[model samples]
Target: MIKFNYPDGSHCYRALHTAHAVFRNDDGKLIARAEKADRTGMYEFEITGFELLSTGIVYD
Candidate 1:
């Protein structure tokens, strides 16, 4: 599991040994992306659009 701080100063935790995706609907436009694996065998990303929603890592 990965632990970090959000942009709002809140502590966040997520599972890193898996794949995940994110989506945003801004002004009726849909934007989507996925987390990429790095050399450290961990997936990393700066997740956004999670201000009011609680999110968790997804494994496939």
Candidate 2:
């Protein structure tokens, strides 16, 4: 498994799984990180839950 640091500043990601996050940069480039939740299994959250509330899809 490849490991990476989360991007700088605030960020949003597509949750592929409990341990994976897919992030798209401003340039439209994409990357996947290895971890999403901490040891307690809490999520870091994405898109402020607004889009998730309006639609089932997540946005970046």
lDDT for residue 56 in candidate 1, whole number 0-100? 75
Query: CA lDDT of 52 in candidate 2?
Result: 22
Judging by lDDT against the true structure, name the best candidate.
1
- Candidate with best TM-score: 1
What TM-score number comes out for model 1? 0.28
| Cα RMSD for predicted model 1 | 11.5
True-vs-predicted CA distance for residue 51, candidate 1, Å: 20
Q: What is the TM-score of each candidate against the true structure?
A: 0.28, 0.25
How well does candidate 2 match the true structure in TM-score terms?
A: 0.25
What is candidate 1's local distance difference test score? 0.42
Residue 6 deviation, candidate 2, in Å?
18
Residues 20-54 of candidate 1: C-alpha lDDT, one tens digit per residue: 54444555432323344453443444443332223
Kindly report which residue pairs in candidate 2 clash with one another: none
